[model samples]
Target: MPSPLVVLSHLRWDFVYQRPQHVLSRLAATRPVFVVEEPVHADGSPRLEAIDAALGVTVLRPHTPVGEPGFSDAQLDVVAPLVRRWAVETEALGACDAWVYTPLATPLLDAVEPRAVVYDCMDELSAFDHAPAGLLDRERDLLGRADLVFTGGPSLYRAKKDRHSSVHCFPSSVDAAHFGQARPGAPALDEPADQRDLAHPRLGFFGVIDERLDRDVVAALAAAHPEWQVVMVGPVVKIDPAELPQAPNLHWLGGKTYDELPAYLAGWDVCLLPFARNRSTEFISPTKTLEYFAAERPVVSTPITDVADPYGDIVRLADTPAAFVGACEAALDAGDADRQRRTEAMRAVLARTSWDATAAAMGRLLDAASRAPSAHPPTPTHSSTPARATSTL
Candidate 1:
């Protein structure tokens, strides 16, 4: 039997399915995979609870009492023991690898003397809104301790590659076959009632409507082109709804399931990546960038570095709202010949990049590092996962 794999993530297992869900689910088939989440206070005091999240992976959550909540100081002290107990039991069985998404999980390195420690830097968390205090320090510490470091994008790799002994850039990858359902001839499910009867030439943007979203840009673009219906999908977080710009052409569809996306995407004439050019967004490699290309939708985005640097030739890029609206107009006016040309070019790119390959590469790196000469001595060789993983929740 293979050794156990423990993943400490800042994101809840049920939160938007991104890199973590895709990679870890596949690794679970051969290794005992446990995705541990920050404490949840459904009741009082902290206890570790594990739920089977399919693919033989377990999602463990630390539940603390509302009064003694959070993973800081005394609270962390309480939560640490419960976590340590679970980790010790798992490690006792065999060698263990601790894969972490957040630098804040640096404390976990002590709880589990993992044979291998992988720091998957999926985002520049220090720059996000309401980021925890002293996060940079923790990240620096994590960088020092990590046996293998994986950055989410090129820009991030450039920023961090020098800081670590070994670092690999694994940009946001895609599940092309699923998003390919948006293409013609794929069976489109019943369109959502609200969007079914809506006007044509729908300009759509989906994903978390958060601080990274340029709401003003969206409003301005919608108002400038009222004939084009601008539909924004996904949950609004960390910002007040009242703060969002309003226009007759703008519509908020809230969040949708992974299954529902292809249908909505199928109806969209153009996809919008209205991301703000701020610290919070500088290094974010939008997962949807590849997804939009996979759907064969014409895309117009602000100067998102990761999106522009790679896909600028394939997708349109403009900074100001006026320029963004103009780009959208150009995309809308694109002839079939022009759209087909872009589609073929993009298809070649998507065919090479996928969540499966990324997961396999990550697995190889972790497995090699686990047996490498290090502080924690090696055991038997670890097993390789059969495939890349994906998940609904």
Candidate 2:
């Protein structure tokens, strides 16, 4: 029987359809995938709740007291025993591979001695607001213990490569068919009521509206171009609502289901990636970049190194609010010929990247690691080139 895989992650499996969901859903085809989430505080006895998301994909949430939701000592105490029992019972015939997205679950290393442990470093967690107290130290520990480490983008790989010898860069990829549905005649089904009345030449953004968002820049952009409508979608976290820049031209469309996104994309004149240049956003690869390209929409964004460096040819990048407004205007005034040329350029790039391709490459890496003999973990040399990965597609 194929070995089961348990993934401990900071991201909720049901939240947004990003890297974790895209990669693991495909992995489920070959092995049982149990996505273990952080504890959710509840009133009852500490117990595990397993929800079946699909065939071979299960979302496991440990519910303890309300205050014990994080990887606090109490939460760990409640989760360790339950998971240990399940891991052993499920993998009696084979050793399960433990894939970790957070080092907060390090206590599990003692409780469940998995055959292999992989750290998928998708973000610089320590830089985020309200980050756990010991995140960096725990990351260091995880680095030493992890058999393999994978970064979410090239910038992240560059930053973390010196810390671990096995780190590899797997930047964000797109689901072409899914996002490509945003064509001229595509139905924008399930359009949120508020978005229906929004004015056009809609300059829109969709994704978590967090601290990484450059609120001042957005406000300035709105101020400078009162005629152009600004639409902000997705949930707001780690920030207060009153703190957001208010303007008559700015519309907060709120969050929408993934299936409903294409409609919004189809209606948009241009897409926006307005992440602020901050510690939290320093290494972000912005999966939305590829998604927007797949949608065949012109995009304007801040100088996010990851997006600017690799995708600069297709994406318009600007540093200041004035520059951002100029880029938006340029995107708006793009002639048919200019638009067609850029569209073809984007398609050529998107053709090389897809969620299926990314997952297949990752599956190969995991299998290769599992089959290789265990050797003493090497110290980071910091200068090695990243390993190449490709898919048959």
Candidate 3:
């Protein structure tokens, strides 16, 4: 039997069904998958809250007394023991593989005796707004201990390739059949309630509303065309809500579940990837870009290096607000033949990769590591998880 897979992530399982959820869920079909999320502040004694998140994946959330956020040391101090206890309780210690998403989760490496450590660097978290201190330090520590490293995009791979001997670039992949529900002739899905009443020529974006979002571009686009109803979906985090641009035609509908996204997509005329040109967005290859294509929607995006380099021609890329508005206008006014050409191009792009294939490739590497055992050795300083001292408490 395959060894159980233990995932340590900064993203919540219930938040948005993204890369980690998609890839891990597929991998879960062959073996047990346990996702350990960042600690949530709570008043009670520290405990691991286990929730079965379908696809045979169990989400383990650590509830700790520490209130500090962003995988800080204070939270780690509380999280380590809870994870150690859970690892022992589940009999996963020394018998499982550790898949890490956040660098700060490196300390918890001491909690489990992982046969192989996979660091799936999904984002450059340290470059994000309000990122916690000591993240780079943690990343350095993690790279030293990781047996294999996977990056979410080409840009990220370039950034980390020199740092690690074994680095792989597994860019985001789309679940076509699911998002295809939004296609014109596919079985009609009911329009989401909030978006149902909105007028046509709707331009929408669905993803995390954070520092990466170009609010200036969004506001300008809405202002330039009052007849166009601009819809924004997803959670607002790290930034102040009151600071968001408000206009009669602009709608910030807040976060929606993964299942609810297709319905929202079905009602949109064109999709958007309005990201700011900043360090926070330097390496982002927005997952929603392929999703929009799967839904057969025209997309307008900023010239983010990742998007511009690979998808420049397929997606309309502009930097200035005027240029962004012009691009969306072009999409909204696209003729039937143009739309057909774009859809055909999108279908071809979707054919190149998928989550299932990505997971299978990862599993192959992991299985090889399991069989070889000594292919990659851990740093001498932290070779094995330290045994807990019963009298410490």
Model 3 per-residue lDDT tens digits across residues 167-271: 877888889888999998888898888988999899999999989999999999899999999999999988999999999999999999999999999989989
lDDT of 1 by residue, 244-336 (tens): 988888899898877788889988999999999999999888889889888988999998888877777788899998899899999999998
Candidate 3 weakest lDDT stretch, 10 residues: 382-391
lDDT of 2 by residue, 148-259 (tens): 8888888888888888777777887888888888855565555556777777888889999999999987998789988878988898878998899999999887777788
Which residue pairs in candidate 1 collide?
Answer: 44-65, 45-65, 234-254
**Candidate closer to the true structure by TM-score (higher is better), 1 or 3:** 3
Model 3, runs deviating above 4 Å: 92-94, 376-393
- After superposing candidate 1 on the true structure, give the runs of residues whose Cα lies further than 4 Å from its correct spot: 66-70, 90-93, 373-393
Candidate 2: list runs displaced more than 4 Å: 91-94, 185-192, 376-393
Question: Over all chains combined, what TM-score does candidate 3 have?
Answer: 0.93
The prediction achieving the highest TM-score against the true structure is 3
Q: What CA RMSD would candidate 2 show?
A: 3.3
